[model samples]
Target chain A: MKHLLSINDLGADGINEVCRLADLFTEVSQRPIPKVPALRGKTVAMLFYEDSTRTRLSFEVAARRLSADVMGFSVSSSSVNKGESVRDTVNTISAMGPDALVVRHRSAGVPHQVTGWTSAGVINAGDGWHEHPTQALLDCYTIRDRLGSVAGRRIVILGDIKHSRVARSCVMAFTSLGAKVTLVAPPTLLPPAVDSWPVDVSFSLDAVLSDCDVVYGLRVQHERQAEALLPSLREYTAQWGLTVDRAARLPVGALVMHPGPVNRGVEIAPEVLDQPNATLNEQVRHGVAVRMAVLYLLLAADPDLHPEGEAS
Target chain B: MSTVIKGGLVIDQTGERTADVVVDDGRIVAVGTDLSGDEILDASGCVVAPGFVDLHAHLRQPGAEEAETIETGSWAAIRGGFSAVVAMPNTNPPIDCAAVVQEVLALGAKAPCDVYTSGAITVERKGAQLAPMAEMAELGVRLFTDDGNGVQEAGLMRRAMEYAAGLGVILAQHCEVDSLAAGGHMHEGEWSSRLGIPGVPAEAEELMVMRDIALSRFTGAPVHFQHLSTRGSIAMVRAARQAGVAVTAEAATHHFTLTDEDCASYDPVFKVNPPLRPADDRDAVREGLADGAVDAIATDHAPHTMDAKERPFDQAPPGMLGLETALALALTELNLPVAEVVGLLSWRPAAIAGLKGVHGGPIVPDAPANLCVFDPQETWTVDPHDTASRSRNNPYAERTVRGRVRHTIVGGQTVLVDQVMRP
Candidate 1:
């Protein structure tokens, strides 16, 4: 309940509860004004340390929608740039009396470390190549929203895996929701161990493409190219990149998705991003709802926040 | 520094014999029916073989201390029954220069195991340029690799092989080409299809293995393939060896013990580079071990902090620490003569790492006394929570395993006894 660092920490009931709450939040997003007073008057801080437009803004938007005061922490402009350590930044922010904290860092455990800094319920927005719990939750909401339940379905995450925090988090969330997850990435992208995670893994994209009902594609950061995680952009697009030809090989109804900032020629073709079933934009919409659910659950769901037991 | 291993079957490449070996001042003083020393250690019903030698290990020190350090990795090495291990060069500064290599070597000076290191083949593992291999080689680095990445460019790799051959150093490859492997997270197969995860074809790894084999042929260099998980890669390596291409390959214990089906659980613990291959490949890895296709059982001991490894399968760092449990897992997973298995764990890899002068053994008098005493028949389950490494990324926890190292002695020092790390 403290830090959702691992899916094993979340059991069947916990997953079902999160999924149920996500559904309820999705319904609330359908209403006009799209706001909730559950976390009204509370402060939720957003600490974003990496390149993220969607996850960063959505947590802010979600906290705002829940009527919780929001503070956006930028790494480059803060004391972090002026030689501040993670512990120092966290302690400095803890003094602000935030009721809940939304942290996204380049290192994987920073959010888990926030617990040592403050008592405010921590929501891992994203950690470096670690879990982006909200993204996984949103992706789960997207899958369960379209499909009735995720108990036995198959989900495949594609691309830039050596560097994608979303894929890591999604697998944790999906597996918890009881959907089987297969991670498909080049060996260069794949790490040397998965014994800790409870997921199926593979190397060939075609192995799981046809069976996957939900396909998540990731962006290939060009900066990683400078590091030679790949040989050439042209080569990667040709072999591993998702093209129209490759998409047609999927199960007839497999939905497509990309985390965004699309590379027209790299991981996925441009047309796939625009495809009706892509859900690339819909993912953005669901992202906010999922964040709202997370904020509500962590900040307002417990009566301890309102020691007076004022409101539901 | 004086101790005696009494009442054990001394097994090594030469053969197995019942003996008591005495070690004094970091060297084996005597091996006979009754050997006495300043200290007496119980080795009854255990195999007294040369200490295990690991060909692959990633000690993420200096920059990534939160994951693993030389001291911790060495502690793991001793617990897993290894006396020496070759530290990979993919650290923060990257072991491309002589200074960084020295730093790692110096750090390992007081470690439980003798830590030999490999220098990067490509500077920063960029795959475009070459690293200062000759200089590092001059420092007695016997292996060279941009191990986290194979030199993607054939020309660069060919040149590296040429240079490596001239220096008499082995080029160890991660053996994955970007074109075939990029964007894929797991092994490309039916399991991947069912899971909706993008798949990386066996060719992603195979193609590189194939390319390197050809490069070895072209340059007449010896290349070591690190963590051969795919059947195709093993088959090719087998064929290349039969063709006399001067090559050797090491398979990780995870490859033989686990399959892609383990990934079906959607756990990050099974998320590894050269992702777990299919069952057939797992079988092939075992066969490769039995048939001598794989020269050694390397741990590929890569450690990542819990958060780095706690993420989803696709985002976690691709490695698990094996130094602490490799020997037990190897014996349990591979169906082979214990002596043969010890060869894979010890002398075979010692020869490969060029530490045969001291590390791996025949348990003879005047040997370096780097040794392990283990009850080959004992059974136990792995528990990550008890590991000596800074990171607890072990996927083997709670799984019952037979064959455990009861004691590990590195250079006559008792680093492990009764399966406990002395340090």
Candidate 2:
């Protein structure tokens, strides 16, 4: 409930609160001179030990618009790559007195460990093939925004869910939000633990496509999967794809969405990803706003935890 | 109690001598003819020196219990005539901080041979950062490395070397660049091409070794290159050492005996990091050992569970068990003089690992009773089925070779005797 490391950590109330905050934050973002003093002077530091463009910049822009001081730490240019231990760097960065720290890493549980090493609140911004909790947050917020809350909607997540941190987090959030989630994969792309998750599981995308209101697609990280897991790319796409034809076969008024960096026509059909009914682009817009609300709620926890004490 | 090792010609890096060594209270008390002792072992047709030292071996405990443990790995070490071996730091919980290092040491306390562990240079082997070298070194971890990965950035490596130089601990590298080695399942060469298996180029390893040597030269830190496989890598190490730069090199026994040709069968057993190179490179590793360009013959003994390693060759993890079969293969395959082979196995590695003070010795009085007795000319066949390691992934099973272990002593403890494992 305190740190959204995974949806399994959030209960029903937690999803509602984040969704409510996201809606208010998005409305405020549309106002002229969108800035909030809710977390004035509190600092948020994004410490990405892995490479990123969207996640890093979104958090950066979100914190800035909240009038919170920011310290952006990048692994590529920083002393971290110089054999500096993650604990040492996180400890030292914590010494600078940031109110909240966002961490991204290539290894799972890095952020989980960083939270233990510092007093600063921690957010998991993608760690290995683990949870990217906030990506799930924005995604949930975007779905709720369109469907007036997705409590009764049937959602089907397609593509490489086994390797997706977002899929893991999204499943936790959506299921807790009262939505029915059916995970569709080609069996080779589903984790061994997939059947154990609190969601309906199916190997054939066609089996679930008919009844789903939201068709969420995942990227096929061809580079990361063990070669023996799946055969050729063309073969994987043919069996588990969300092509436009497949999209049309879904229940009427269904939407197709992807958490970007699409392997065009590989996981989701290109035409389906760009369809007006799909909410992929809307998700990106809602991302920065929902992140802004999260930054505020996390950093402005108390009055005494003020900004003037932070920047120095 | 006193024990006498009778009639073995001792060949060590120091020199060759024929002597009867006497041990009392676990220390080598005398080395001469007509030595008196409470127990005596005949060693007439063998060579005796300090115990062999392995620069690389994985004692996978505190995490992957199904593969290996400190106790079983030590038994394997002694049965192969190694009185000591360095344990790699990648485990369930890595040996990064002092706590993990201390834990590994505690686990190694009752093992058959002396077990010293390398501390991870990067926390959790995520090469995005370096681990605490000074703290780990303070706990007596003399070497540091992210053995599964080389620090990708040259700047990170330079800084690590500078810190390592300041602490006087050596830095060992796995010699791989992530970008270059990505998605590769085997060595990128003719065999891989023919088999259609995705390949990792030899450059992926050589490039990192070359960088580490340059970093060592820049920081004046002694860098130890682990399992040098490429001909280019051996050439670089030879040049660097010749130039008086502080660097030492080791080659795994597989590098000397095996080739990429083995991967043709799509056997997961042959898959390993710094993947098997061609025959020419294998010959270079042998020549490097013969010419002293490569200072030691390390095992790079990696172990994996049956289910984990028995998967498709491209999907299975890299590494093969090495501790139980390294010496016999070196003895039979290299065809070097017994004394010189001992140098590569025992003394030279001891010196390189900075363990000479306690491990490699002259079998003289007042020294640690760390020793091994082996029959130099005994013929044997490698049988993975007979190994003491917990896993069944050794690729060298059922191969014929010569020479075998007779007994091993560590700090005066008879951990292995007459080829039988002892406590």
Candidate 3:
């Protein structure tokens, strides 16, 4: 567990191990004094080249909870805008002797590139259209919390599978955990070679609604409409959105999940988030704990120190 | 001053022979037994052949000197056994006008290797207005292209082809439809899907190749395809040539040697414009070279600084150091005869760049003394730091490659001896 760059890096066992460790962190997150000395004296740096709110804040909370010092480099305020290359920024930050770097960039492989530039462990907060491993781990934890186990569950990831890092990560994480993932999107919104993925594909949300154990709604980026990936968000919503009607079609206790900063009445109806089975809030809550587990695993806990740490 | 290249099996357009070639006044004066001259260049255990001619090279001179200058790129070319290299016009102030073309030629005048340049098909390569091809052609610019960007509008390309046909110059296209290739950082395939990078579909290249073939037929002008990577594009070119559409194609060394799978490491060094494709496409390119469908093997040797390549995959500029590695890669990766590989790298590309009688050799009396001496079986690993080009974005760095240049002669000058460039 040198870095959590991709969900694919974590196999079925690694996924389960993360979920289990996240369970321990979730318990600690509930305690009145949640701070732990597990990562004390260690430092974690945030290099978010892209604008991120939830992911950055979640990681900050998680690092603080584990008692690790946190340093941040926002692109807008930093030397990045002064024409400093990603390599220079990473090298400069790495010189400060951080144990791990949490990187988010608008390019798919920036985190992977950062790994080469720095000796520190790397956690991909989110890279462009690529995997958001922590988000996926947290999603796995949220699902396991609700359904008790991910195995044998039917998970339908809906909308914008082409550009959503969340959907890419979730599909890998859920499918790795033995949950069958069905990706539902307009043919244009789906990735060009999604057929190679270990998942079923559907065009209509209505068709797959009754069969799913979990409906993972991906945010339909409105900018894609301008790119002509979709005709309009209204059309995307009418076709693939987890609307009030579509949510009603799910069998009793079927979960609705969305990685946050959701556009209301776009990928989902306004009332859908209010549903009891909706796990958007839970996904956010689990994001912090999952990140705490990841930071602990990368920065604090030694593999030999863990009771049954499988060689990754 | 006369020089004798001794103990080499000379392979040229006229075929192979064990000959001691004597050069004086920039022309071969003798090709016979025990030739004596003022200077001796030992070519023992070497295949002395016509020096390779690269139809595509980005010397990055006139601008972007931080990446490559004419002197450095030409020296790299000499090291790679290329006596001549055509500079692509994608520099900062692109080689579009007569003055720019003249400036590039003058700058390359003192280079160890011959540096010819391609004039831009459009002004500044913006693809909107036609460049002064005739004026640039008068300065010996033989090939014209908007290399980094394909001329997108069909009508504009048709007009450019008509103009090039009249000017008696060939228009080489980079063969990408910008609308189709928009925002794509690599080849669109299962690998790209897995990597989550936006993809440029093979159709983006094929569509333009298809369009140019039609335009060539319509205008009755010859169109040359640059760095044809996709299998479909090769098939189209093969068919169009069979149909006598006057289309010639060249494959870059990397297209046949590396694939899109190389981009999995997320190292931007592997990121190229026509982006490395799948093994199937790479094999197709190889087959195209083996057959007569592909005419030449050019080093689309674009150079970029380390800082530029250090950016993320999508943000990093696409190119790799190629002038230093083309011949070795062709010899190591392609399962073709040495002569055929030489033809692909030398005579064939020389013909495409309109350097027929001047460069590609017959190794007889009065032929230009441009020759390369190489041990085809010698192996050397590529080291980016050891190269003469001002960039280190070599994807083949650390890759063991066969066929090293032993000696290179340009215009009767021994520019490289015993694998070292003359100071």
Candidate 4:
């Protein structure tokens, strides 16, 4: 794929290929040196237009581990703060010849727009309520590592599916991997056209919790709550929050995941983060390896660099 | 100086006839079998009709001249077989009062097409207080609208309707409830869910359409619905018409020709206000047009600069250039007879825009000679870069469409002849 902007951009076979490549990177991550010379001379730029701590740090670590040079564009200090247009900013950074441009913008399709302006392999880190392909990939990697496979798995993505790019991408990735995905959120938290999605949707989280092989909690965007999308944080936590009782109801050995800077007691119980089944920390770790796979596949998969022949 | 448009089947509200039209001193002096003038413009095997009139278009003048000025928009309108267009009241400073209306009218005086200005229904389109309807109406502004946004307050909209009724002016609405349509970039449907773009539910538009229909009934004033994009909105309009409500509606060319699925590419060009809807909604728009439930195919010709349009689909302003492609798209996409198509583009919209005597015509003598000659069978691909407007946001670029405007005569002056603008 020219760009990892959406999970839908990768079909079942393409997703499987990415997972297989990520397996090799996962092995590299466990090594004593934990470094690879695959992307030795390449450079990757991380353009974060939105405030991000985990995603930004994970991508920077991934690039460095691959021995690739990294350039980070901070929205606060860059020309973006001076009202520079996305095109102007992309062009300015593109002139430096970064092989892959990992962009995270508050707008849905900024990564797609960047693709048109630059030759750099564009990666959608996390755009506004749109797909975050790398997050989905890491989630898939975590799921496969624990459960052996995602196919036929009952995956329930819970919480604010409407505002969660993670939910959108995970639904797409999981469904492509043959998982039967169910989206659980309040009617308002679900997108208006959720019925048309590949996954079935449910509002009652407790009813589906026991049947799920994976209970993925999406962050309830508190910013949207000010618009009265929700009644209040208390009501939301009461209804959709993955509390201790809900976590205990999950099928034995079923994984519980969250794409964090978790709201603690809002989308998930504060105690749930410390649970043995909670893969939130593992998701962050897998994020590095999966992103390393993506960068290597996109930037350094030339025939000369791939001495063992291509992954395909 | 005079021009003769010869050897074409002249079709107008009065019907079709083989005629040669002669124009002089900004009026059609003769239209008969063998009329002749000092200049002859060939129109063989073409449908010669009154130039089209758009009830809604954003000329973006006074403040947003970077996207479109009256001169450039007029050229685009003429190239699309339009002799007149009602410039929407949603410009930068907005045409909310007599001064802005007068300024737009003055700019239109030098344009190729007759540019009529619509005043805002609410002051500055804020939906709080009524604009100076009397002053604007006195300046010959027949239509008032808070277009780009609907006047959200029911009381204010009612007051504006009553005031407009008293002034003998029509109020047009852009029909979207802000609360429901907020943060939405495309119609809420299958594509929107899959693409994960925030969706504007059809009900957001339907609720306002329902409100306006009731408002029209209560106030006994005519309301023109702009760019009705949903099945529910069209069905409501159809039912309202059946109930004898004094409401007229126009659908944009994109509403009937495109759908929300086009937003799959996440291209902001397909992103428009009332956003492209589902397939059923698209079909309903077409059905509304063919069955006369809809009055005119108005081009909501909104022009945004390339830089503005290049933003991500959600952040980008909603609009697309339509003045240069509306007629061709109508001809290519709608399954209607050429005569009915001409009526939608010509007399029907001309009447709606209150440009009857000056624009849409019977093509008879002394009719001011606003006419268009087009080959209905001819086909051409749209190139956005070839547009006359200052912006390049045409969604129909690379689309091969049948029918083309060959010549346009506005006020007896040959503005466009053989697809070339007259200097």
Per-prediction TM-score of chain B?
A: 0.98, 0.98, 0.99, 0.99
Task: List model 1 lDDT by residue over A1-312, tens digit each.
Answer: 555543434555555566666677778788897787888889988777776788889888888888899987887788878966666777788899888777776654556656666877777777666566667766776777777677788888887775677777677667766788887877777644454457777778877888888888888877767867788888778777888888889877788877777888788988777777788787789888877766776777552222254331
Number of the top-ranking candidate, with lDDT as the measure: 3
TM-score, predicted candidate 3 vs. hidden true structure: 0.98
lDDT (C-alpha) at residue A270 in model 2: 76
Q: For model 4, what is the alpha-carbon lDDT of residue A37?
A: 94
Candidate 4 has an interface RMSD (Å) of 1.4
Per-model clash counts, in order, read 63, 3, 0, 0
**Cα error, candidate 1, residue B329 (Å):** 1.4
* Segments in model 1 whose C-alpha atoms lie over 4 Å from true places: A1-312, B189-199, B260-269, B310-315
In candidate 3, which residue ranges exceed 4 Å CA deviation? A304-312
Per-prediction DockQ: 0.05, 0.01, 0.84, 0.67
Docking band of candidate 2: incorrect
**What is the C-alpha RMSD, rounded to one decimal, of candidate 1?**
9.0
**Full ranking by TM-score:** 3, 4, 1, 2
User: Which candidate tops TM-score?
Assistant: 3
Per-residue CA lDDT of model 2 for B3-45, tens digit only, reads 8888988666668788888888879889888787888877888
- The CA lDDT at A105 in model 2 is 76
| Clash pairs for candidate 3 | none
Candidate 2 residue spans exceeding 4 A from truth: A1-312
Off by over 4 Å in 4: A303-312
Model 4 / residue B4 / CA error / Å: 1.3
